[model samples]
Target: MAAYLYESSVEPHAMPGNATASAGRVGDTSPNTLGAFCESPGQPYDGLPCAADSSTCEDRAQECHGRGPLFDKDLAASGELGGYGFASNREVGRRQVAGVREAMGLQGGKGGMRPVRSAHAYVDMGGYEFALANGTRVRTCPAAMGAFSFAGGTTDGPGAFDFVQGDNKTEGEQNPFWELVKVFITPPPSKEQAACQAPKPILLNRGFAHKPYEWAPSTVDVQMFRVGNLVMVIVPGEPTTMAGRRLREAVHARLVSSGIFDEQDDETHVVIVGTANTYTHYATTREEYAVQRYEGASTLFGPHTLEAYIDKYTSMVPFLANGVQGPDWERPQPPSDAPPKEQILKAISMQTDVKFDAAPFRKQFGQALEDVQSEPYRAGETVWARFVGANPRNNLLLEGTFLAVERLDAAGTWVMVKSDSHPSTVYRWQRESTILGTSSVRISWTIGSDTPAGTYRLRYFGDSKSLGGKISAFVGTSGNFTVG
Candidate 1:
């Protein structure tokens, strides 16, 4: 019995010309100080003649530049991480930890951290660009996936939630449909990254604003990072060398101490960092803090060095490792008395019709059948199942299910594959379903172009109490679609 871990990031598509407008708490006030890019008057901006006086020309000029005027006003602006109104990664990380611990039966009673048969996590890096006088360029933070590796589960999972879609959906449909599922908070698959269209002015306007003299961000980049239970976010700060690194360390420490690691101590951990979520300010190291010093000093951690910086990190790690505990955050464990097999089967079949694909089943079954020289039609695979619903109304009905698919291979050996069954929008019951959602477990394998083609049978089992007695389907295969 193996468990799987998933991770990913969520971002609203506010790009221009989008069918619907985007909305949410876009910008909110942040701490007086952000990461390391110190905020104060007289900070140099692109070598422009910044006035030395604090309350006079310098601060006033910064306040005056609203949308443009480029560099001078930009001097006061730190990176976007410092100002946005998004859920803090520190909090997200803590919740993930608590959820898993409770789910595995480790938090309450006498049970310690339970062994996870598998783990999956995903994070969203807001975007790839950050603003500096020269121009926007690629930025990387420690936790944006580059920092660690994820083990124990499949890499494929749901992509980041579409905030733009949520905005367009009626209130009745605004459930956190994709919230708890895990995705890999990975880097842009390639350098040709996707850019969000400019958001509607209203959506853009919701961000933090500048005071008479206070600093603000001209742009934002949001990225998500995940390693095992840890989800790290790199928010851009004012473009100070130290801002990004320092903030990352602080937030990372906070999450580690929040019980994320402790909850999954037995599993191999991974870390994904970089700019993927909304770009906040850059989190820089102590060395960067010293080299490119700025007034944002108060915002940057004091002591200005990596050794000192790491020390601060160690202290907060505990908080991030063990989160605030109460009954509400606990995940439900399987009841002591296992339900009847019928109930389990029903639960497995309880999925709504999503566009389905027979590829996964075909591949897994095909491989086994070919290997053993048995007919692929009879051999099948079974997968463990779990259901995760967006709301409580469907919670009991959708939370967990086990899936078992079986077939006989070319040889007589009965091949079975089991997955901790779960629902996803990607799996469509048929190719032409009107609605789009994620569900289904696909198991696939490839045959060479020259290999013999034949008909096959793929059978699937959805075993869970919530399914209400639906029967599994069988797909008869035709010629192999193997590419030469």
Candidate 2:
């Protein structure tokens, strides 16, 4: 099959509510006219780029913010400070769709795909030892988050504090207050541990801290899947561009040498499938690790992390060779050490359970608090309705929606045209009175330019919990409004 590769951005940060927004755009099959690639960087307070090393503006990370293509427009339209980034998210998704279409058009499909083969293993990354290609022996340290992790987060979400990224300060140069606080949170790293994670000034010695449970994963899942000449390296964490490229090359070379695919086979492809199976954090090239940026600082297993993964994945290539299949196929021995089952069993959750939900006296659940306007609304205008609501945690509404935008058809029936899944639709819940157990929900829809001109109504579906904790469903409908 024809293969196409596109590298639009490195470490493209995600925005709030973007998960549903982007998914909606990708699912929408509508034609798009947006450009195929758009580079979005953090918006600077003074309209200048953020500091290269710390990603800060005036030495303050909170001043640097990521801006989407439609950031200003969305912010102005919503009037919500620090806009949700929905507009930009959808635009990016549209660009992705356009890119896919262009790529497919340029290279038509050709099929001779091979059967799928897979391999998986659970490895304790702590102290994993191996030899580099140059005959240098090295090992990975236990998982530990560095001070730069708190370097006011990333451009995607700037955090509080005086910390900054790319911080490689020696102990004396480090913040004296935080240095004392670190001892109270988790045990201070020993000299050996500190040396192992050199250049990464430990903020939290997660692997060594096991009070409530394992703070960081000591064991991670390593897996791979092969189809035809294409091999996917399933990684446990995010891998930077260079790190991922090195991994792919290492695996590709191994596959060629193993005779699974000849070096002359130009069709052979290896790709990195990141953040799969488990989470360890980020993987960066040794050079990037040395730089100690946000990504490199978050590289849990020290500077040798990428090399360790490359070594493990390359060693497992022989298992994916042709004819390695079925019950008859003999597999190598499994690792003796696996992650402790208690690590999960003893895991703790700080989130409190839903107590109960109730509507104000004489205001029944799902009762309309603010109905839609009677006047006609034009395309691109937003219409909304608010209702007395309950704690939605009472019912997640899986395979269902909390709200819908219905269009009145010629047959005199309301047809569900849009749900909460649509990028243009939003479902927001707010607690009005915690003591009274009262809440409200606002459902809004931004009418698309291409939306059909007709009468439409807003509907809300909710579930309320009684004093005894019984959940009952309710529905509310708003009066019809014209879209012209």
Candidate 3:
């Protein structure tokens, strides 16, 4: 739900009177970091070991909330991988797109691709030790951490504790992905591997962990784009609320101190746009990180995550100091060694066609049974429409809307006034019966009190699958109506 809203909310409605932005996933530290420090399996809320049959959200949430900026003994000791290593290639390592392991020097071998290991790895198969930045070292192994991240799981997502809607913390712990992923959880190592791991403590998955910043390119670059007095700091990761707040303050302070603006000047404003440029990881305050929740465990840069970001932004202040072309102490950063080339994983389709036994239940994919309501709607009222829906994957609607409310313009341009991204708008999909290949879509727009009085229409765009198993796109429009 959050990921779907991110592009629509962040890209379009960042300005005042815009859409609300929510975040979902982030490019952060290896998932193993959590198991090592947090994932208290079978531990109940009262800190007592769970009985034979018990594991609740209260137990999980209580155990995890406010845990860290805690140090990973293994990752901290791991240090950086040395030598002219490989340069990062997102194409070869898509998972590393957002400052993941490959960028942190986990892909430090000689070549253009990050090293790959079998899911059944039993040792430090990913070369996590010499794989980090040049000067770091680690006692833990990656395969062990892989087991924890992939096998043992954590608090969020396929984690052991995730709860579904309406779940009251009393349901059993089970994730949908567990069945498909359990095999990948590296099996317990052999005698030698076990010996290597025996000396190491805090093996969350009975494996190792990756230090976030152990890479040759330790100092990351900060990008600032300004249009007039509005300065935007584009960070590499999904910085926490605190991280964003501090960044704004630091940039604002720099601009004011450099004589670019007066104190608390109305003409100047600064904001932080996280998950920009290259993906680093989470940026949290030393305080928040202390309670290692999902955010802290993912704060790859340790306790001073925000402080490091502040310094990075401060260094770039020289650039924003004298305008866009001012002195940049860190521009044209020196290049590092190239990463090794390795084959990356590709997507495989497993979709099959469904044959409907009844002619009426047979949907030619994009057939709509219930069209939108056609009538005058006043402010505070909701407009609804239902359609014969198909798989939305046929048309992802990237940087686009699945639904739109257009208000006719003076010259009849039909400008887009509202979209599925709007807070008051809702789009839902349901398969009335998968065996019958019958499905329906519901879209609703609760007119805001401030909505302009005008004629408007709702538009829904989707894709349908043909009997021959071919998927194609289609659109449905609602009748125009007046809003008063």
Question: What are the RMSD figures for all models against the true structure?
Answer: 22.8, 6.7, 16.4
Tens-place lDDT digits, model 3, residues 14-115: 412432332322333332222322335564434333221112244343243111223232224331211111111111122322333233455322344421
Q: What is the lDDT, from 0 to 100, of the residue 332 in candidate 2?
A: 48
Query: Could you give candidate 1's per-residue lDDT for residues 158-264 as a string of tens digits?
Result: 11223211121212242333222222222222212111210100111111222222122222333333433544433333323333344454555455455455434
Pick by TM-score: which candidate is best? 2
Model 3 spans > 4 angstroms off: 1-232, 241-271, 304-368, 371-379, 399-425, 447-460, 472-484
Q: Give the poorly placed runs of model 1, Cα more than 4 Å off.
A: 1-203, 207-413, 418-444, 447-457, 461-484
Writing each residue's lDDT as its tens digit, candidate 2 over 142-168 gives 988888554557666666688787887
At residue 441, candidate 1 shows an lDDT of: 32
> Against the hidden reference, what TM-scores do the models get?
0.22, 0.87, 0.47
Highest-lDDT candidate: 2
Better of 1 and 2 by lDDT: 2
Error of 3 at 120 (Å): 38
- Candidate 2 — which residues are off by over 4 angstroms? 1-45, 77-82, 106-113, 327-342
Clashing pairs in 2: none
Deviation (Å) of 198 in candidate 3: 18
Worst 10 residues of 2 by lDDT: 20-29
Please say which candidate is ahead in TM-score: 1 or 3.
3
